[model samples]
Target: MTFEREFFYDEVRDGFYIPGIIKRFWAYELTILSEIDRICKKYNIPYYADGGTLLGAVRDGQFIAWDDDIDIMMLRKDYNRFAQIAQKELPEELSFNSLEVNQDCEELAASVGKQVVGFAAELLRKYHEYPYAGSVDIFIVDELEKDPEVEEHRSLLLRRILFLIEAIEKHGKSKAVLKEINEIEKIMKIQFDQRTALKPQLRRVMDKIFQEFNGREGDQLAIMQFYAFLGNCKYPRSALDKSKWTPFCGMQLPIPEDYDAVLRAEYGDYHKKVKGGGGHGYPCLKKYENKLKTLMKGTWDPDYHFSEEDLVRPKIQNFRDIAISMAEAFKLSHKQLFEDCLKGDISTCISRLSRMQEEAIAFGTAIEQKKGEGTESVRVLEEYCDALYQAYNALSDLTALKEDGIEKQKQTEEICRSTDISSGLQKELEKIANTLLYYPEKLQTALKKDFKRQVVFLPHSMKYFESIRPIVDAVLKAEDMECKIIPIPYFDKYGDGSPKEMHYEGDAFPKEYKITDYRTYDFASELPDCIVINSSYDEFNQVWSVAPSFYSKEMKKYTNKLIYIPWFVTDEINPHAKEDEKAFINMEYYVTVPGLFHSDLTIVQSEEMKKAYLAKIEEFAGKDVAKKMEKKIAGAGSCLLGEKEGEGIQNVVDCFRLFLEK
Candidate 1:
């Protein structure tokens, strides 16, 4: 069957187009991301994120929720390498098209290289009507030459070549994909010959060579070996400083050294005048807006031009003819014929729509003629207006289908909703569980068994404790693990019961709440194989000193088996009545804030965080603790903690694959 003509309708508006454009855009972006990732992995090309992609990762740890585009850059060399491999390495449905290599230049130039974009095929097919949708830009950067004259020429040449290649590739691929395949092999041969002839005009030849060998069984394998050769050309991380990039709301993009001058030359005072449509629901380019105004004023009419009168005056004449024809064609249903005529043809529809205008004009003419006092013809015209009204509505619907953004949004939401869960809260919880549950099934199994591995969970509140009971019970049932949550007292009230007691009933009863004997409930003596602690002042102080010391005396009881889990009062749990669960106290290792507490080892998000944690340990517990922590943390890297050792603890928290905000 052909592609479905289903339209995404807005339930609220009783029409199609606008509600979830952002969501559709994001989904498309993610698909692109996966395609990029797959291509990069196959080629073994290390390309650092550029433009919006990198900014989103470094600043927000994710993509901007509303962004519809994905821009990534690779070094000129890697880009060339990727181009060489794109044909064979990329999927048939998803291949890269570049300016330098592709055969079609004229078409590419016309569409501004959109047709040659790696992600264009899917985008064009998916959102054929979306005006703002364009191809993914693969910017290639080269090392700046030291000699001024040579540098300038090289830069200019590079830019010129890039533009030319982009145009060529765009047109080439468009032709290749959309071409009639009367003889596939013959066409392929002709295409290759044309490409070879155009090779010298393009910048990179090796890329084209790679494209030649791209075959069904051998593409990625060939690309991988090719990439391995160029791996050494990668630049050091210090070459790009993220802070130097240009800011865009919450994101930033790497700018040329003379960014301000470049921007001014390209589009002066870009910041002074908004470059995009922010207030409008759909993204209307500033250029489009100017064109629209001009189009409306008729000073510079577009190719497919139509003025109000030009459109209506002719339609009125056509409608009058159609009305007379309908009266003769089907005498029994003159009204129905007139009604159907409006929805049938725009030219005729317009005429039928202008009847009222014609009547008004006639009345004015008659009034000028001094016959306005008696208007039987106008009265008769007024009675026949009902058919015209229906025609007008039908035409309006057709016009609206073209302009409404909500239609695409509705379609996208419908597609996504049918395929995946859309509840924001449910998605969040799943993200959290997926992120937090290390070794997922294993963790679930561990929770299910009766291993009764004593877990020291830092006190959040009674409700939190109740919520975690399932997580803990699941782990125990899976692996016979038993967890004991460490109760911490509120800092404001010293006379209150121990934090642990708050989880139990009867907190209001003085006897039930009081910590009668601290020695009897010695956490150190009762320390199980594993300890889960929260990152709290009292817990940090105790785990860093009191618990470790008192617990050390009984360390021989269970030598090395502590697992620290940093948790928070997840949205799934009771959040209003209690604070979040921050630390997990195990018998051996305690996971707390990377910089705040000294546990056996720590879990961090990035290599940066891992370094930060090590540095913090060195500061708090001396170089020995830092070194030891580093070794221990390094040893446990296989666990799915989702971070390096020294990165920011909060980064890890944020990355926890959980729903962070509502």
Candidate 2:
């Protein structure tokens, strides 16, 4: 069977992106910008190239070649003056794309200005179907007052204007492309006739429509600032204090001097060489050596647009914004607790509070099972429960108790309260403080021992889930072990329908997001005796928890196995054990086979990868089991796909096919 495939760009009638168009369009954008700057300087208009365009220029002395738009800002007063000058001075081919009268044309224009002319030229030349346009964006920057209330009012108005323009652009008002062009021509004609020397004041007024639209209530200014900082700069890790004074786009934009230190804390080495590419013709710029290329695909192009339908789009919400949203959502949900009035409802709240408290106690029990505090996050959770209980009880009793009321109210209060309002809730809070507490530890213990006996190799995404039947059949056939190979739903992230099913796909992922050294390992405990993890430079310690001390301690505690597998490491250079490293720790006994070929019973994915891995094992283990196992490996080393020695060998596909063939 043959598969019919096509590149992503092929699907679009006139894909806005076509590789080289970025650079060419950027050059034209820059040239137009230079002209703007020249005119601004002559008239003393305070302006600065801002946002993504500014970021690209300052960071690398070039445009963010992947980005498809350019942004520049002018003081609101200067912007008003420049609007007048733009109409009279700009060449016929070049003009300001107002966010008003010609919103559609302006949207099209902004989209074009962001594209590199050369890249667009190449696409037009090659495919002869790509659309072309020319444009630039002018952001009017008003001096925001220090007061949040005033800033909020102004921001609401600005956002409303933006929404109207976007709506007009996305859903064209005209019926046809020709009709839209004619509309633009009429607008320009009206503007030209109104002015004697052609000042853009009329067009500028047309851009700002003060219509009667209810203003949205939210911290719009803060939201705008957050995105501006996140999308435009390499933010400092901690407080972002340094970002306040640093230069942006050749202007003294705000940034703190200690910004470099904060950046290093989060993205270590801030200047590492990084390899980049993801399907497209050119390599995208990367700040770190192993920055995920997968997440970066198609985000910078003009044509590849994804919708942001939610009122608060997660795709764009910054860390602070997320926190605020979460807090609000939680508050709103909590209001349901107070919406009803009854002694019974209060009891329900008491039960919930009790459960949370019980969970906290259980956490303590689990900590005792482990050698030490497993993770700091667990400890913080324990503290959160304690605080929550204190708050809940105080509130519950103050409202529930009614000493001044008659006998009936007094009896109801005593059931949930102690002698006083505070003590009653406090006693209840103490009783049920330890529910799902050490569950993770129990899971860890089970994983190390009982779970290791049965293991299955799972892809990031599962295609043929039923394919696991043969493997189960083989295991049962070999060891009299009646088992199952669970088929997990795989999300085919790379175009295909490959599922990304992993045993720990849901709850097991770290609750809090952080860049740390602890790595998470997956593979259901009951499925296998041990798991082989793939690693990268600094990511291994953080992403998979493969440190020698952690591995050995875990191995000793549960008698269940937590094996270390190294990829990209060779046996010859530091084979067996390096003198400086711990004996049990350095590369031996961890049982790693290269991803490609394993001379041992291990199956490698490719001949080339196998050859490289085998050479290293031979150099280190010398004439040991690694060598003996190499010869025993049957049917080309490529068959294993890096499965352990003595285990069954089957192609990823063959594993599924065997059940059918049977």
Candidate 3:
């Protein structure tokens, strides 16, 4: 099978065509195999090309250019040896992941994994992880008994595995394993001791199978993961123990000495070509992982770039000019805001960010009306500038959410993902994936957009939403922001899974936003940038339920986070609030700790009020819970402002401006 041309790998690009994703996947594949080959040669430990990779070598001489996966195997002893040293042996780019090496995932699988046979561990790129890029599968082979009884047992296991695969195909990988337990319970008619969905009771069963097959002295051997698929994957030990070199993608690599025998047994027609035998790679969407990375790193050029002219453009002839001024404002405020975030000065950060959003909204309106929707450059610039402001707010709010002195690096890890163990690079990749999933096409214009900072102002009702609009607008005035203020219905957030809903007439809602009525269902399609829960007087008075006690698990779907804002001021304990006929009895007069606890950041009346809330938290939740809650409680205005009535409103407005100026 010689050709006129030699498909030799190049020094710089290997055999890959530059800028092609599939080529890149192949390049990484060869890099891993070459590294593995070096280690095996250097250590004098043997491994042979197994499965499709070997088939590719004997059949194609080069990689089946379409094939994206690489497979190799070692005998149990060699496999153990590689496992012991593969981390140090392989390039740092390659990371080892197997049930034995990654006990965390192994145990996770054992407890929650579906009824599966032993899993084949893999070596993957460190940052890429699974299903995102090319990875190597290392099959570990053990001697198998070629007996009728053993064959029947293997067949039964195969049926269960078939069921497992179907379950995953129907449901998903995450839920497939859990449902396996249920299927087993129904079919087997036996209740296993392990009860929790997250528990791994199959470890013992798998271990018994491993021990049973491993102890048997037989002529046949098989990779444990594929025992059901490949019955008695037996060959003379010399075929692998003794190896031969063959040309694979222009490199001479070891395949089993009796490669034909192995291939014939595995593929039947080893010399034939199949049209369906195309190489598959991970879901290509993650290739755009860098799209978000670039965006977050502030690499993407927004439609409007900020310049000094923005500040000088007095009359603001165009939206791009407006963007320039806004960008400059952000540039000045960003440093101060970042420093404040590090100090957990979230009160100041939130205030400034809120103001920035308001200014952006005003500018956006000018552009929308003057230039109209065709002013995409203006709109995009507005959105991106808003995102930059929101990103800062998110990070600052994140600091407040964390324990004091936690490094910003650690803070990013927490902010980027829910689980603490998630890697930094992994988090960024996930952030991109999440952003793509969370926002609809209309809202995804700016990759720099920080959904975390985009806030949903969920007013208790139309009346409450209307009442706060004045204050919200006052803060937003002159600030470059595009945050939307959407109103929600008033009801017991904590009630039967579906809470009862009520409505009132004659309340004009905020402009440019649809009122999310509590009708047939909650809004399902759109996710909020941020959910700010306003604990207004109308809210407490309208319902007998207190703010602290009124929480709906459903609201988490809208946004997993919420920021609580104290709109009502009270000096007494257990202030009974009444709206119209409905009265909320036994509501805490001094503070709304229950509602505040839900907020990543709680905006209170003043520093003195923060202290009062801390005291209340300590009294009600004890010292441990209070310590966690103290940082979140920050006051933006004085409690005495409420006593002065109209003076209070002015003071609140002044306070917002003061924060923005700083």
Candidate 4:
């Protein structure tokens, strides 16, 4: 199967590419989620999707293409209970790995839930390290504890210092996951005078904070390990109390009730534009070499418990290189950035973070378009992953620094006052967030028939263009919205027509269209912002509906909604057949069967027309298609604004408006 640009888009590929790898992983993910849903529903265990999993559920109602992990959050109590019951309840192939079992862990798992990331990690784990690798990543959310009016500023400072100390200590302890990374940070010869002594104090602060705020439900909640500053993240308490079921990877999953506020707090604007789709910042999929065998057996992990010796360092180091390399470009150092954040130098800290953000995006785009997961591609992926990790950490630490800005100045003669990247950084994140809204999915079904512009595909024979012009004109005239009519003349059948016979209705589809070697396949890119094909009404195929020769699959690449209008109302227009060639030919049967299966919305001339099409579908396709076709197919006589002509193109135009008004 050829690679698809997207993980899941159901249609006739213009160039015949099938996304087998992503599709297989998609199947595996759905199975695990479905099982989890079964258990959760049985117990009424409340969990809202967290991280990229939540992003996927909301953004496109599916997993972001490169995202491999399924992250979900639970209140501490619910998480504890689910973990206990899940061990035996989950099948052998599925494991519930948490901090207790896998000790070399830094995943403030609230408790590590599941790591539904696909092939690479699982297969590599057979030859490698890291313990918290399940199908789901679980994090804990605790209601904030209120006691002694917790000094948010002091606690915030303590948290940053503690995190920095821990990070610095771990710096040289673990081998740089990449060869280049091992050498890159040599310049950041970071040193801390009180590191050893400070760690003991850091523990005390952490313990004291958690002890004091352990049980109280003050106002906000804590999502990570830092319990001292109970209210720093300040997620609304109401976000977790209730949830609504949202579609995710083709399954309905629970999401926080107050998702808007939650997403804004976490991602600024969660729906910005970005390349390669979004999720927890890594596409953990492996090429589907064994996809068929796995799919047939229906298992995500054939060997859930594999080896534990090899290193994913080479894998993870590349990202470290990308982050620090990009940081150096802006003359900023990650070590310095973190150190500045510790001393409350918010200005320099954010400046470095801003650069990190840029590197992360550009680096991520390069990874997404990589031709294969070769050594270089893996390095890019690791860099992309690490950059995101570092960037998010920077943002989190920045929040902490701002919280403690007032006191840090008095303690140490450092820059004072809270600071924020309210300008370019905010804009940068917003732009990237909006870019993520348009990821690919299984199918682009138009749940409703709607269009901003109608690109009417004319027949190879230019004569039909003038005849249908009035109907197109009437439809444009009827709608209140702006309309651009593009009359694209193409060979309407299996093989016929020269592109040279073009008649332009507007500048959109020029009269003397240049690309004269026109084939239906060539029009995919030039399609308007929105369009639809009438299943039976198109000028495709022979005049009669019996022969499928006059077919137009030109609209297959259209990501927008496809609308259907009844083809030449033969019975109504000319009932007397076989006697007059004009009567019979013009009134020939319109075969809608070609377009019936693809309809997002189907419009008909009358209620009887809807029934006739439904019955025909039932006879050919089956009762299932007929039943669904019945609901999607509609007949309104006409929804046009102008006076109705019982037998003109006006009726078809009116049908076009039915979906829009709907």
Q: Report lDDT per candidate.
A: 0.35, 0.35, 0.48, 0.45
Query: Cα-based RMSD of the predictions, in order?
Result: 37.9, 30.9, 31.6, 37.7
Q: Write the per-residue lDDT of candidate 2 for residues 318-398, one digit (tens) a residue.
A: 222232333343344334333321223455555555654575566445544432455443454466566557746654664
lDDT by residue for model 3 over 241-357, one digit each (tens)?
Answer: 578888876578788888876776666786775323221223232334344335447543111222222112111122333344555564555556555544444446567666656
The numbered model that scores best in TM-score is 3
- Measured against the true structure, the TM-scores of the candidates, in listed sequence, are 0.25, 0.26, 0.35, 0.34
Q: Backbone clashes per model, in order?
A: 78, 68, 19, 32
Over all chains combined, what TM-score does candidate 2 have? 0.26
What order do you get sorting by TM-score, best first? 3, 4, 2, 1
Candidate 4 structure quality by residue, lDDT tens digits, 410-512? 4433223332434443434433333322211100111012213434433333333343444555655654333433334332111111111223323343354
Q: Which residue runs does candidate 1 get wrong by more than 4 Å?
A: 1-19, 61-67, 106-134, 156-237, 240-662
Best by lDDT: 3
What is the Cα root-mean-square deviation between model 2 and the actual structure? 30.9
Off by over 4 Å in 3: 1-19, 104-132, 161-211, 230-238, 277-662
